[model samples]
Target: MFDWPLLRGPVPSVVVILGAVSCIYLLAARGRRGWWSRTVPIVVMIGVIVSVIADKVIDHVLYSASVPVEVLAWIGFGAGAIALGVARAWRATWWQRGVVVVTVLVVVAMAANSVNRYYGEFPTFRAALGLPAAGEVAFKSVSAVVEQPQLPVSGRALDQDWTPTVRPPAKGVVTQVYIPGKVSRFTVTRRAYIYLPPAYSDPRRPLLPVLVLLHGIPGSPSDWLTAGGLAATMDRFAAAHRGLAPVVVMPDATGSLLGDPMCMDSRLGNSASYLAVDVPMWIRRHLQVDDDSRRWAIAGLSYGGTCAWQLALRRPATYPTFIDLSGEVEPSLATRAQTIRVAFNGNAAAYTRATPLHMLAAAPHPSVAGIIGLGRADTTFGPQQRLVYAACRHAGIDVRLLVLPGAHTWQVWSVGLRRSLPWLAYRLGITAP
Candidate 1:
C-alpha cells in the first residue's frame, strides 16, 4: 500500500489548516455585516478552502496508490460539489460572482490535472480548462510508481556474470522473482521488477550489458512495461539484431521530493544508495550481466534524469554511460545553495560536489559516455542540457546533445529513447548476434 502521509507533508497540511481556520473565522464574523457584503467573502473563502483541501487530499491518496482514473473522477465530483455550493451561495455583484466562479473553475481544473497526473487519463473537466489531453497519462502514472519508496536497498551487487535464479529460460521461457531489500523491506520487494534479456538464456553470450532504466518523478517500474512498452521494444530490436538485447532494470525514483524521490540521498530516504548500489548488486548476484563499469548504462527522465547523472558521476566505476532526457542539472552552488541543504541533507558543499556538472570539472572519467536529449519546447531543456554539455566538453568527455521538438511530455522521452538506443548500443559494443 502507498503511504498517504508521505504526500501531504507538514508544509501543505499547515497551509490547508490555516486556510480552513481563516475561512471559518471570516464567515462567522461576516454575519455582522450586510448579507451580500459579508456572505460573499465568507462563502467564497469557505469554498476555496474546502475545495482545495479535499482535492489535494484526494490527489495525494490517488497518486500514492496508482488508483484508477474512475476513482479519481469520483473524488473530483465530490470536490466539485463543494465548490459549486460555495459559488452558488456567494452573494456578490456580477464581477465578484464572476471572480468566484473563475476561482472555483481553476481549482477544479487543478484537481483534474492532479488526477490525470496519476490515473493516466484526464478527466472531462481538464478539457474544459484547456489542458492537454490524456495521451501520456500512462507514462505519468508509471513514473509515479517508480518514484515511490516502496522499494529500497538490498545491499547486494547487480554485476554477477550469470545466476540461474535471475536468468531467462532457454528458448521460450519467462520467469518472475521477488527479492526483498533492507531499506523498505516488503515494500521494496513488492515494487521492484527486474527483466532479463534473451541473451541471458544463451550460455554463449556471457557478460551481457545492463541498462538501469529509471522513471521520472511520479513514475514506477510498471510505467516502462505499460507506457514505454520496453519489453516489446526490446523484443523487436533483439529479433532484428539476431538475438541481442540489454538487460533492462527499472526502479521507483520517488520518496523524498514531492513524495517522489528526487533520486537523491536525502532526509526523506536512501534512494541514491538503493539505486546506485543495492539494485546493481542484486542484479549481479541474480542475473547474467557484465559487472564491469564500461558495460553499464544509467538513464531517466525528469527527476530520474537528474538521478542518472548523479549516479553515473558519483559511481563512475559502476556506470560508464548516462542518458538524460530533459533533466535539470542542479544549479550552481552560488545560486540556490539552499536547495541542496533541503534536498541533500543540509550539505550544500556536498551537494555541489556530487552534482555531475561540478564533479566532471574536478576529475574527468574517460570511460564515461553521455547523451542528453531535450525538447525544444521544454522550459528547462535547453539551459539544463547546456550546463551538462558544457561540463562534459570542459572535461573532454564523449557526449552527445540532441534538441528535438516537443514539451515535457513522455512522447518526447519515448521518441528520444528510441532514437538514442542504436547509438547507445554501438557505444556499449552491443551488436546484433
Candidate 2:
C-alpha cells in the first residue's frame, strides 16, 4: 500500500467519489431547526469564498509562475474547511460528529489528490511521504565506487574499445549529496542528488559525460528522481548501449523550497553563480567525470527550464546544449516592474539586459544548441516558447521546438525528457553522433 500509485488507476477516482458522498451527507445533515439550516448554508458559503480568495492571492500576488493546481482542488479545499467547521460548531449526536470527522479527512485527501494529479509530482504514497525510492543511498557510502582518473588533455567521448570487465549493475544508483555553495556563498543549505549509470559500477570507472537537471519552483532536487523518473530512464538508455549513459546531477537552483531566485545573481540569491560556477566546480572535484564543456548539458522544467536557458546563454562554453521544458521566455514575479524590483533590487537596466531576448539580440551564439518542449494545451507558455524559438534562430542557435500533449504538467516534462534522450545522447557523445 505504501508504493500504491496515487495519481492514476482507481485510487484517485475512489477518493473523489468518497469526498462527494461525504459532502452530500454533510449538506443534508443539518438539524431540523431553521436556524441550524440557515447556519449550515452560511458556513458553507463562507468556506467557498475564503478558498477562492486564497487561491487568487497565491496565483496572482504571491507567485509569478502559473501554478498547475486546478479548480477541483479549490472545491475540495472548501469542502474540507466546511466539514471542519461543522464538526466543531454543530451540537449534534456522536454519530453525526464522527461522520463529520470522516468527511474532513476524505475532503482533505480529495484536495491533495486533485493537486497531485495536476503536477504528477507524487505518483506513489511512498513518494508523497518524502522517502527515497528504491536503490537510493547516502553520498558518502558511494564514494568508494567513484575512482579519480587522469584528467584528459582534449575532450574525449566514450571509447569504442571500452567494455565492462565485471558484470555491471542492472540499474544506476541514486545518491543524495550536499554540494557546498563555497564560491557563490548561497546560504540556504540543500543537498544535490546524483545518478551514476550502470557503467560507473565497472572497475575501470569509465569517465562519463554529465547532465545537470534542475527542478521547478516549489520543488526540490528529488523532484527529478521521483516524478521525472531519472534512474529508470537512464538505466534503459544505458542497457541499450553497453552500460553507457551520462552521469546526471540534479542540483538545488533555488535556496528555499518556494524561493524564486530567478536564476540570477542579485538580492534573492546568487543562484546564477551557484548553478554556473559552484555546481560545475563541485562536479569536477567530487565526481570522476568528463571536464569537457562540450560534453556537459543542462535541462529543466518550468522555472528550472528558464534557468537552463539563462545558463546556456550566460555561459555558452559551460552548457552549450540545453533542453527547456515549458519554460517562460524570461524570469518574472507577477509583473516586470516587480520582478526587476525584487530580483535586481530596482535595477531595471540590469533586469532588462538579463532577459533571454535581450541577451540573444546582444550577442550571437553559433556553438549553442537547444531543444524547447511545450504542451499543446499550454496556451500560456506555448507562445512564450515560440517567441524564444524565434529569438534563438535570429541569434544563430541550433534549436528545435516540440509541441507535446498536456498543459504545464509533469506529463509533458517526463515525456519531453524521454523523447529528447536520443538527441541528447548523440549530442553529449554517449552515442555516436
lDDT (C-alpha, whole model) for all candidates: 0.58, 0.82
Q: Write the per-residue lDDT of candidate 1 for residues 227-345, one digit (tens) a residue.
A: 55466567666665545667777765553223554555655466777777777777776665666657789988766777788778778888889998878766222235545766666
**lDDT by residue (tens digit), candidate 2, 1-433:** 8678899998998999998886676666544565455655666666676667666776777665444446544653666456554655467778767767877778777877888888788988878898887888778766764444433334344645467777878898999888888899886568889999988777777778889999997789989888877888889988888888999999988977888888888888788899999999989887888778898999999999999988999999999999999899999887888888888889899999988888898988887999999999887888998888888987889999989999988899999999999999888876665
Evaluated against the true structure, the overall lDDT of model 1 is 0.58
Lowest-lDDT window of 10 residues in candidate 2? 148-157
Top-lDDT candidate index:
2
Stretches off by above 4 angstroms in model 1 are 1-190, 202-206, 255-261, 331-338, 343-345
Candidate 2 runs further than 4 Å off = 34-44, 67-69, 72-77, 80-89, 145-159
